[model samples]
Target: MEGIIARRVIPSDNSCLFNAVGYVMDHDKTKAPELRQVIAATVASDPAKYSQAFLGKINEEYCAWILDSEKWGGAIELAILADYYEREIAAYDIQTTRCDLYGQDRKYAERVMLIYDGLHYDALVMSPFEGAPEEFDQTIFAVQKDRTIGAVESLALNFARDQQRKRSFTDTANFTLRCGVCQIGVVGQKEAVEHAQATGHVNFQEYR
Candidate 1:
C-alpha cells in the first residue's frame, strides 16, 4: 500500500475544486480561474453534450456562473475536467469515506486526489517529494497503514444506507437542501428555510 506524502489545502471560498486541480497539475493555486475558464469553455463549446439532464436545472447560465471565481464545482465539472485533461479523477467524500471515480475509460488515467467533505475540496499527493513538509493539518488524512480498494469499498454502501435512514426517519419532508448561493448541503428544509430567512438566500433546491 502507498502512503500520502503531502496535502495541499485549497481555499474553501467556492473555488476549491478548481484550485485543488490547479495545484495538483501545476502546483499553482493562483491558476484556479484559468482552470475554471478551461472547464466553462469545455462545457460551453458543446452545451448539447453537457447541458440539460447532465447539468440538471443549472442551464446555459451555468457556464457563465462557473467562470466566476466564487462559484462552486462538483461531479459534473469533475467529469468535464476528466474528459478535457484525459486523466482519472479520484474524489473522496471524507464525510462518509466514499470514493467517486471519473474518467476510468480513458486510455491514460493520471491519478489526482480530490479530498472532499461535502462542501470543500482539497488535494493529497502521493510520496516522493524533494523537500516535503513533515507536518500536516487536520485537513489531511494521510494513510496510517496499508490499504486496498477492498478496505474502502463499503464506505459508499454505508453512505447510501445512512441516506436511507435519514429518508425513512423524515416522512413529513423527505428531502435535503442544497444552498443555491454556495452549493453546500444545509441538512433539512427547516434549517434551510430558516437559513434563507435569516440570510436572504432564497434560492435552494430540494434533493431527495
Candidate 2:
C-alpha cells in the first residue's frame, strides 16, 4: 500500500513521465507517524478498511532523482520495514480501489532497509535527494540493459558512487529543501538547484 501511493502518479507537467520523486518530509520523517499514519492505517485496518485516509501525497516535482531512467531509474529503493510491509500487505493480498501498500513487496521490500545496517550509516543515507550526486545512478534501465549485477542496489551503489567521488561530494554533504507548507525538503534549498534547473546552482534566494 505504501508503494501504491507512488505508482501511476501522473505528474501534472507531463514533463518527466517517470516516477515523481521528492522527499516526503523536511527531516527524516519517512519513519515518523505523520507519514507513518499512511503505513499504520494500511496494515491494521480492523474493518479491513482504513478509518481515515493516508496523509501523504505523490511527489511530482523531482521524480528524476528517484526514478529517472538516467538516474536511479525505474527501480524502487527498499527498506527493512519493507520486509514487514510485504508480509502484512501480502497477507491481505486483496487490492482495494484505494490502497497502495507502498512499493514494498517480498522481492522489492527485501531491499528496504535501515539508513545504515547497524544504525551507523548516519542520516546521510536517509537524507533527501536534493543535490544527491548519487554514486550508483546508472538507473534500472541501464541495469536491465547492461545485464549488470547490483546495478539497482541503491545502498551499495550509492556507497560506490560516494566512494568514487569521496572528496568532492563528501561524507557529510547531503543537501535538502522543504515543501514550504509541508516543509518536506525545501527549507535549506535557498540556493539549491532542482531537477528541472540543473544549472541553477546553490540556494534559492526566493525561498529565503
Candidate 3:
C-alpha cells in the first residue's frame, strides 16, 4: 500500500486530509515508530473498518470526495462515462419512435383505458413524456372538468418504456372516461396490461 496514497506539498484546508489530522508529540516522551506504521498500514489496507472515515460526506463536497475516494477513480472519470452512455442511449432511442413501436394505428389505447374502470376515482396517474405533457394534462382536465367528481387528480409524468411482451409503445395517448362522467384519466407510456390481465383483470377486447 506504500505510494498507493498520493501526497503533495499542499497547505491544509478544512476539507484537506492534513488539517483534519495533526498530532502534537510530547518532546520528553518517546513513541514507537512501528505503532505509527501499523496504524497507517491498517487504514490503507481496508477503509470499511473506519466508520468515522466517511462522515461529513453528504455535504455539498460529497461529489468531490466520492471522486477522490481511493477505492474508485476521480469524478472526471465517472462524468465522462455518464455522458458517453447518455449519448448512446439518446441516439438509439431517437431512431425508435413510439408511433413506430406501438404501431402507427393506436387501436390499443382504448382497450388500455378500459382496464382502469376500477381505479377511476383513485387517480388518473400518468408518466412523464417528452411531448405529451400538455396534451395529457389538457385531456385530464377535459375528462374531469365541470363534473361531479374530485378535482382533476394530477398524474406523475414519466418516460414511456417499449414493453416487448405486451408490445405497446405509449408516447402519445388519450383515455376515455367510463360513462363519460369524470375527466381525470391517466396516460401510461405503455400498459403492462398483460400483467394486469394475468391477475384476472378480465380483458374485454382482443389485442389486434
Candidate 4:
C-alpha cells in the first residue's frame, strides 16, 4: 500500500532550512551547526564558483554569514547542500504551490522533499498511516522510481494547496512584527528591514 505524505514541521529558531535538511538526510534535527560549517567550507573551497557576484556578498563574508545561526538559508544553501549530499532537494512552496528541484540536472540517486511557507522550511515524509511515529517515516525516495515520484509529487502539491487555502503562510510583505530587541512594532517586510538595518536588531516576532 502507498503511504501518506506529511509535513514534519521544523522549529522556528531561524535554522529551519538547515534543520529540515538535516532531518531528511539523517533523521537528525540538531545538525544545523555542522551543516552550516559544511556550506562555509564548500564555499571557501570554491571561491570562483561561489564568488561575491553569485553570493551577493564576498566569499569570506558569505561564509561567515552562513555560520551565524540567526541567518536564514535559501536557494544557495539548498543547492550547496544538495551537491554535498548528492541528493535532489525538492522544495514545494505554499504560496506558489511550485516545486523547485535543486540538483535535478545531476540525476541524483535519491530525493527529499521540503515544504516552504515563504519564511520557514519543513521536511516532507511518507508514513504508513496518517499519524504514524517519526520512526516509521520515510524521508528519502529513489529518483528513478517514476511511480513513487509521481505519487509523492501529487501529494506534495495537494499539501501545499491545502496549506495555502488555510492561510498557513506568512505574508511577509504586510505582516506586523515586534522587534525582539527593543519591543518596537513594525509593519510589513519593508519596515522590518528598515528597522533591522537601522538598529541592527534581527530578532522579530510576528503579531496579529
Clashing pairs in 1: none
lDDT per residue, candidate 3, 85-200, as tens digits?
22100001211222111111221121000011111101122223333432232111122232211221111111122222233322323322221122223333123243334443
In model 4, where do residues sit more than 4 Å from their true spots? 145-148
- lDDT tens digits by residue: candidate 4, 168-194: 888888889999999999998899989
The C-alpha TM-scores of every prediction are 0.63, 0.23, 0.14, 0.95
Could you give the candidate ranking by lDDT, starting with the highest?
4, 1, 2, 3
Show where candidate 1 strays beyond 4 Å. Answer: 1-5, 127-131, 134-208
* Candidate RMSDs in order: 8.3, 16.5, 28.0, 1.6
TM-score of 3: 0.14
Error (Å) of candidate 4 at residue 107 is 1.1
Please provide the root mean square deviation of candidate 1 (C-alpha atoms, Å).
Answer: 8.3
Q: What would the per-residue lDDT of candidate 2 be over residues 86-168, giving only the tens digit for each residue?
A: 42111001111121233333334122211221101112222224344433222221122322223333343454344334332
Rank by TM-score, highest first: 4, 1, 2, 3
Q: Which ten residues in a row have the lowest lDDT in candidate 1?
A: 136-145
Model 1 local distance difference test score: 0.63
What local lDDT score does residue 178 receive in model 3, on the 0 to 100 scale?
21
lDDT of 2: 0.26
